[model samples]
Target chain A: MLEGTMTSTTEITHLTFDVLVDLLRKIFVRHGVSETTAAILADNCARAERDGSFSHGIFRVPGYISTLKSGWVDGKAQPVIEDDGAALIRVDARNGFTLAASALARPTLLERAREQGVGVLAIRNSHHFSALWPDVEPFADEGLVALSFVNSMAVVVPPGGKKAIFGTNPVAFAAPRAGQPPYVFDQSSSAIANGDVQIAAREGHSLREGAGVDRDGNPTTDPRAVLDGGALLPFGGYKGASIALMVEILAAALTGGNFSREVDWSQHPGAQTPCTGQLFIVIDPARGGNGHFAERVAEICDLTREAGQERLPSDRRFRTRAETARTGIPIKAKDMALLQELVSE
Target chain B: MLEGTMTSTTEITHLTFDVLVDLLRKIFVRHGVSETTAAILADNCARAERDGSFSHGIFRVPGYISTLKSGWVDGKAQPVIEDDGAALIRVDARNGFTLAASALARPTLLERAREQGVGVLAIRNSHHFSALWPDVEPFADEGLVALSFVNSMAVVVPPGGKKAIFGTNPVAFAAPRAGQPPYVFDQSSSAIANGDVQIAAREGHSLREGAGVDRDGNPTTDPRAVLDGGALLPFGGYKGASIALMVEILAAALTGGNFSREVDWSQHPGAQTPCTGQLFIVIDPARGGNGHFAERVAEICDLTREAGQERLPSDRRFRTRAETARTGIPIKAKDMALLQELVSE
Candidate 1:
């Protein structure tokens, strides 16, 4: 199916956002995904690609198809929401994609946040294989603050540890700003993201120092070594390690999901997605009685840039999104061929 | 007053926790702190010292006295809690210590978390100078998960920024465990905390590499340079910078408090504490329908330790607490003398 194909030809094709989403939707449906779930995932991936989040965009499509074929994740499963009439909402994703669960729970989460000034959404038995910014940005666009945590497969070790006991756990946050797009950031607790390491290995590049260790638990800068039985180190030493541990507790333990170390998908040889859980905390800034919350966020962001911080998190993505909107999303010809191939496979 | 006096005499005095608290309370009362506020502040400081958090312990008593004398903080001010009958509670600290506000709002926060499955406490116009772990550990002891954020004075610069735009912002988390004390951690987003830098400067030690920059924005390992006119860098480059920005938004902007950069104390010379904001998010883990929530937390923590991470965030602090309970808190002779002098003055 032309997986990981990069041709010498510099041919590029431009596709409108809608067109890309529709094409990806077709690909998902062709591989046993339900129409509703396909639509949500397609839009998520398309948005990431348009915003220049290449690792989570079409680059992950092959993995999704393989996992579906291996029956590692239920492509047609429906998420069940448990409403205790409180600020906390729980969702059993039935081993489906996390996006489906999140999409179904968004309305209830928003209502609770508006009513109670805060809300928590916990989803378990789900697969989250996309960028986290998309999971949270919508809440910010609606003028609420949102934070999310999700744990992936175990590919990272605790600081000074030999075994991989943690995932490339990520934390995401979004807040509204005055007269501008929302401020958003999604960061991995690991020194480097697993996707970046995979990309570097594919492109024959060495990793930055302190990023990961070899199979023997010795520090190395080789992406290939990290991919082959090695593991990543938490960023900023013990501080980041603490954050990674926090994410595990918030996302897995609190959500009644599997810890990264417990994801036993070896039976499904082609599975690429980690069957874990996700947690979200949403808050209404108006509850603080601060009518100027958005303005203050904008003020601080501007001051940061003025202080010589050339770019803020999601700055480049927003810029890329704007450019992509004006001129369609650019895709390599080889990647386009792969998408076409998947539709009829 | 014998401030900053470290005599060559090695004589140390062991004081029981209550005795130390009483002495500190007298000193606070002598410095214009109200009786109730003094009790709270004294207990907080005493706990820090007992837990081996020297930077936030009695070492900060002089700064507290100096700020009070400068009329920078309202020692007698009462915190007012605004309950919207939702999951969010707002506290106007009236320029008092954040510990007082947190103490006053604890009951309401706990009630809301029980009723709504989640609760948020936003405290504005507050000075949070003590360690954050104390603010969250109590909630965890009640079998709830708690997370907190606070912004101090702007001593940390954004990544690649010449000017200091963020505080030594800290995020603390705590969760219940089945067979041990609450899992807790409080860490600053900066490469080095402001108090640590102060202690290093006083003790004649160099800062760690990549910790701070001098007045001209040149990297320096001298702690004195970091204190004079220079700034500290965020840990882990841009990722830590993002966390610091999130803290500002949560603690200051959402709480209707001053941003870190807006803390202007020029008129109140000798004022050490920053009058800023603090935020807390508490959740009832039982709401997720995870009957074994505490057990799961204990499991993950055990796995982390077994993976070769010998020391967790609060490991040493808990050990120190146990040891101090039997041996009493040891204080240098000079520090004891200073405390005695403050009580008389």
Candidate 2:
């Protein structure tokens, strides 16, 4: 709650998604990318906004292009599948974009599930994924329960032994229903995700309270302190820390990818220790005699909604997508200016 | 932490587990349970203590036996497989002891996983099991990844809502490895499990600081008030509540069991409710590339161990299990006296 930076007359505006995405694709193409990569990047940028993850949308494109041009990411490198068979697959991103690798892995897992009734894929040496829900939606749409987890560079300290030792690992879960929004819960174990802090910094805002500690391990309210050596606090302290640890093991540890201490130290720039490791699991219901697992899932959804919670986990995003498709994208004036400048290349 | 009566003692010894179980079994047998049911009851009582979960161990038997005699629990009843098949299972616990039913479900899940590579079981209308780790360990030992969750009477309140709307849902996760104990982490989303509060109360000690709140939402150090109308604060506030909600859906909602406002309002003597639900999932490594999965998992374990944290997630449980096996069971002074009394009966 304390993390948003204040804005006065910077003048935020709402632009249609297509208009904005086209603008982004143009900029990415100008920055030296193949059409394929540019489209994915555009989708990554647009999808986040459409999904209400504006912080990871076009606001990040300037920085992304800078990194791409500086060789922190390859616009043309192809991700290599390290291993494949049965119900599992592993992919190496070859220092290429993670969205590319993540986008690449989701379908692979789904395909495996189609054949084997379950699927798992891990990715290492990849770029950062904007939001986990996007990567998992495709699977859920195919009538599967999907779970996703990713470990970031260390920003939060471990439980007792001090000093930062793990990242604000994020977890995304979705269960499909026949005629309703899936029960969706996506969360980061940290009090506030790292991207929130980065966004605050970009907007010149302050950090949320209890979100992080100063370099001294003493709690602080400053956003900059969190972005620096100051450690981010776990969501519910120990329980949150435990979840982060679980995600770290599953995403980084089990995936043969980088853990907290081993991750890239690249907050500002440089050849980062390939931001690595993620897990995608898809479970099919028809095998269990649950006669249309999705139908039962719909029943459960009705109960939750009746309890006064929202009906659809992804309803807001889905609505936004439908609206954006019909109307347009929402882009702020400053972001629009930046997009134009970056594309003038 | 101040949610229960409290007393303090110097230190407990290995006699604690066996002594407590002996008393609990006698109490259950005296309350009209068959000898086998008594043993199962005793096993749960002792397992909780052996695993350092004294809160659920013998400390609970007296009240549980009283509840059973009052017909709050079906002492002579058995779990019936209301539904079953390939990848899924649904058990009608028939109001039988949750421990016994869960114990019964473990092997079934493992057997199914052995054949299908993945298995799931949902149980409803059951009593509370002492702990979940004991439930999932067998599957882990069988070279499968296992996870189980249970929803109890409301303990954790949802965010932005004053009413208690979710349980301090407990989750247990276990995975197999080459040698050593299976990696396991059993946890409650609350700051301190409600059961832990009861233990502190009996020990005549004050609850730990910052553990819970009294009814007015004001911080308090009174155990009775904290447990009475006051609610248990989740481990990480909103994040903890979020997880409680997640489990509420997955374990209770999915199981078609009572949840949230639906649980029987009585955990004490002379009280009963139809409130209960649990879910168990097991994945076999053999079909999912078990060999490579194990190797990758081993590497991850190595990374955690090498980090030199006092103990990785499962270290304490592993150490305790080893010590128990070598030196017999652990017991406390008061518990031993209680056990002696029960044995005499």
TM-score (chain A only) for the predictions, listed in order: 0.97, 0.87
User: Docking category for candidate 2?
Assistant: incorrect
Q: For residues B109-186, write the lDDT of model 2, one tens digit per residue.
A: 666666655667777777774777787877777777777888887765544344565677887877776656777777
TM-score of candidate 2 relative to the true fold? 0.82
Candidate 2 interface RMSD value: 4.4
Per-residue lDDT tens digits for candidate 2, residues A134-207, read: 77766667777777888877777655434776777888887776876666667788888888887787678887
Off by over 4 Å in 1: A1-10, B1-10
DockQ of 2: 0.22
lDDT (C-alpha) at residue B344 in model 2: 65
Error of 2 at A270 (Å): 3.9
